[model samples]
Target: MGFDSFAMVDWSSGNDTGPRPRKDAIWACVVRQGKADEGPTYFRNRELAEQWLLDLITTEIEAERRLCLGFDFPFGYPKGFARALTGSDDPLGLWEWFEHRIEDSPKANNRFDLAGEINCRFGGKGPFWFNGLKRKINGLPKTKADYHSPFPERRSVELAPEAKGSFSCWQMGGAGAVGGQMMTGLPVLTRLRRTFAGKVAVWPFEVLDTPVAFVEIWPSLTLGAAPEGRIKDAWQVEQVALSLAGMPIQDLARHLNVSAAEEGWILGVSQRKPNIAPPPLRNDCFALPAGVNWTPVDEALGLLRERLTVVTAAESLPVMQVSGRILADDVFAKRSNPPQPNTAVDGYGFAGAAPEGAQVMPLCDGRAAAGIPFDGVVPGGHALRVLTGAALPAGVDTVILEEDVTVQDNHIAFHGPLKQGANTRRAGEDVAEGDLVLTAGRRLTPADLALLSATGVADVPVRKTLRVAVLSTGDELIEPGGTANPGQIYDANRPMLIALMDRMGFQPVDLGRVPDDRETLRDRLNSAAKQADVIVTSGGASAGDEDHVSALLREAGAMQEWRIALKPGRPLALGMWEGVPVFGLPGNPVAAMVCTLIFARPALGLMAGEGWQEPQGFDLPAAFEKRKKPGRREYLRARVRNGRAEVFASEGSGRISGLSWAEGLVEIEDGARHIKPGDLVRFIPYSSFGL
Candidate 1:
């Protein structure tokens, strides 16, 4: 016995049709499935529309969902449905009262469409959502015009529960509402600001641009009582009611508020998408550029196991046993920090009662300095002034500073106030027994060392510095000061390597440069392996006759891997020499630096007990205006400029200047060989490798 509902879409009605077009009308039964709207019920005329809506609702039963009828027409007639409900002879007076209540609504001066409003209300009421044309009141516009557009042109005066003042809920049609910048032909965005506020929203079709997009507004209805303004068609209204059926009535109102805001009716919104996690990296030996995406530098670090190998003092020296080493353990107080109370100011020590305001002078007694205890007691009413940091005399609870009292006739003046226990440092004031003194992982700064010394802790446990022996091989390499003979290169790698190791907190033993002789190389490698925790040799891992470092390391232990599919340092080698990790880098300066950063830097930090380290990479638009075929991954030596990172002009792999001028390396993957200007790219820092 609920209200029967029907939907009428008058696609042809417009300004050209008549003074007011019955654009679309719907008469429906608002039940579990929606209004059983059959055919056109309200488009014939306003009086007929009201009568049809009244008939639909009057025939309703006491159902869960409301029984209502929505007509695709305006209800602001000469005698509105409210006047009829009031049973008053003064219909205009009733309208005047209603107008006063809804005085905030915008003026509606133009003809409206119904179907379009139904579409927009459901389109996800973003800022561009439109309800309906502003209907002028008394030929005067409302001072504070509502920025939020009106609802559909549908009339619900009769369908509303019109017993008293304002209907708690009402059903109306929204069609031909204007939305977006152009306010063109788009369905109305039926917006419900508050379900019980008595203000219903309707949009004309002329406001929106997408019909199908309008249905998105149903979930946003929070305040209004009816769904007819948003979804007018029989099936669509049924679907909307079903979607919102199970939700709490209050929750429905909240959702409407959110939708109204989304439709751009409200101010302050966020439409930007959130950051997405990068796709996973490939596990293949040669990672394909498009196989998967690399994770963020920080997140990617989780996959990296620490390269640290903790060797004990029997094998490796503890940091505490060595000077200038970082503290590995926290040192704490066992007894009171001060141990016992002492004088805070310099003066004298005497035991005996020195009454308040009493002043008695004693002849110069033997001085009691710091670390020296006093056993003598002063005579009654005698005072003892003590120096700062001096031990307090027994039976003496007070020490008066010299400035507080005067000495006359061998008796101190007693005008000033005498603090009974002034200037005294009680035992355990600074620190109590067994308190935490220092924590582990301290870097042992100068102040830290002082604290340790103060706490009587000289020897402490610390992470042992990894001993690194740097070696450079190649007959063409000469010492820095040595005159370069023909085909001889000044040893740039040695100096660079030494500096790199120093920054990494390594005990670098400069083994100097050695010729690429098989016997000499083998002996030097053995000597370094026996003494150093890590051994690095340059110019011998590549495929060449003089590249004998790998062979020598193989003689000592197994060679893990000879090369990776990387440019500039394809022949880099990872191997063990006498059980010591050995890195064999390319002879070229740039290649050596790159290899060190990518492979060796993390290893050294691990050995030092440092936290896990990972390379930081930033994406920049490529500055170079060129293209190349995509295939192998390339690390271009580049410099950042004006927010864009550009490859170095001297990009030759063998050019030493490239490493010096380059801020970082650009990683190219996924068959992305050719790069265009302004393309985003990843730049890896040179210092990331401890370079």
Candidate 2:
């Protein structure tokens, strides 16, 4: 269905504690709300804006025309935050709480005092920070340096995997901060909702397609909305309004079922539209060690060889039981194939070559059947009965049989022409003795097992299965089944990595979690070194105060800083613990998996006695376009759609769900500045990485 009007409010804080018809207030644009061209009005203060919005919405409702209104501030805070603030879990209650307490007027307001009052209710010095005025309030600090919030700095919506350059709501006075706008704006929403009652609907918090709907809009998500000019915010509101108006009604219907209610969603971003425009390309996208030579795909394999040594310890197992095991040494044929020349067909055998124009031959007294061959040679001009795979008698040069000759009472008459050596076996024709069938470093497959059995080989020397121990680091992580505190979240990386290792044919040993304590973390690594060939860990690899993995390795063993030139996998740390290789992956789930596949997978292959292999890449047209900076390679979680690689909308490493949503990875080459739609991009299917 078509909306009768598209409306948006470009909001402003206006004044700290007062409301007047300020020069820079709110720009309300209501495009053609019912009866044609009735809105696109401006408001000087939030009170007038709310009154205008409510009146316009009321007019549109009476006309029975649906209106879609977009707001420029957050609809809700982080999950559980609103629930903590209000007795009820509903975010509407938070709005009501704000509305009941805030006092708004034309020339003066109590926004700062109101903020301080709200903070005082929530443990005295928190939840709201930053003051525009020099006057000090009891709870609200006067400066950013003095501000200390008891509440989280960011909301759950602000922490979305790909939602970048977001402002913290707790910071109320800064230019980019949305805290003041939320404080003043939420009251307007509450008043509008109350005045309009059943006529107004809020997105994510309410079902879509209502009479009048409100949605949170971010102008930045719409690329190209602003013209390149010296003047900023000139046509942003108009262009964004048009963009939302032009979007298909069917696409708008998708917002009816957003998953999380406590933390609202921004318009135009969805799970289905993975090929949406990417964030502005910056030089920081290329993350790697500065001024250091980095290797490309092929050269990286060689460098990996130079850095890592293959495991030498070998074990012998039956060929049938070594399906995925790599061979330690060459496998030779135990016996020659065919052993001796056997009869190719069932026919007669004779000692002499074929005679010209001879159609009849006598039946011979000797008969050669498989495993019951006649010892004597057949007489000339006589035929000997032979079966397939039967050994030939001495002086028997040819074999002719059943189909070509007619036989009665042991006497056979040749009906067709006889040929020499047509149905007889020759010794050792297929395989010579001691032929090397399979070489070292070859992983045994089912077909390889069959080939070995056919050659009379029972067992083979193969590299032992790599024992990979997985450990999850960080104190904030708790196991999935266990209870967690307010700030704690269940460990996602460890489960994902453990399952990945299992599917990749490695014996994964669950080494469990290591707390933030340095001594405990070191002790866990020491324990892993005793039982594991490779210790794979997530978190505690970065140079943060809580990270102890790198320091432990540097003091106890060895550490090599590759700092790979790749996106989503750049923060990889490689080290050794008591001669055992350890891979310190990024804490972010998405980044850890990418690093595991491209870096750790190949290294493990080398340890398993296989050659280093670069996961193959496929070239396809890119479905999305972006301005990029050239330095390191980038991999996007993407899917194949209509022959194009559609990347996931988020570039956030924290979005773990994208991994399951993507079918493959789109690889961008180093030194490429931009990617345009229809540009051939190298794609690596998740299957290629054995993920």
| Candidate number achieving the greatest lDDT relative to the actual structure | 2
In model 1, what is the error at residue 35, expressed in angstroms? 66
lDDT of 2 by residue, 13-125 (tens): 75432333232457666655211143334566667777778787888898887888888888888666677778676888898888887777766667788778877887657
Worst lDDT window (10 residues) for model 2?
223-232
Measured against the true structure, the TM-scores of the candidates, in listed sequence, are: 0.40, 0.52
Residue-level lDDT for 11 in candidate 1? 21
Error of 2 at 70 (Å): 66
Worst 10 residues of 1 by lDDT: 180-189
lDDT of each: 0.49, 0.73
Across 367-465, the per-residue lDDT of candidate 1 in tens digits comes to 456766655755545555566787776656666666666776655664435556666778878877777776654435566665555666656677767
**Candidate 2 residue pairs in backbone clash:** 18-109, 19-106, 341-425, 341-426, 341-427, 342-425, 347-400, 347-401, 348-400, 348-401
Decoy 2 TM-score against native:
0.52
Error of 2 at 576 (Å): 1.0
Task: Tell me the spans in candidate 2 whose CA falls farther than 4 Å from its real position.
Answer: 1-301, 343-430, 617-628, 638-650, 673-680
RMSD of each: 27.9, 25.8
Name the runs in model 1 displaced over 4 angstroms.
1-305, 312-321, 326-336, 347-367, 377-382, 396-405, 409-422, 429-449, 458-465, 499-505, 514-523, 540-575, 585-691
Model 1 root mean square deviation, Cα atoms: 27.9
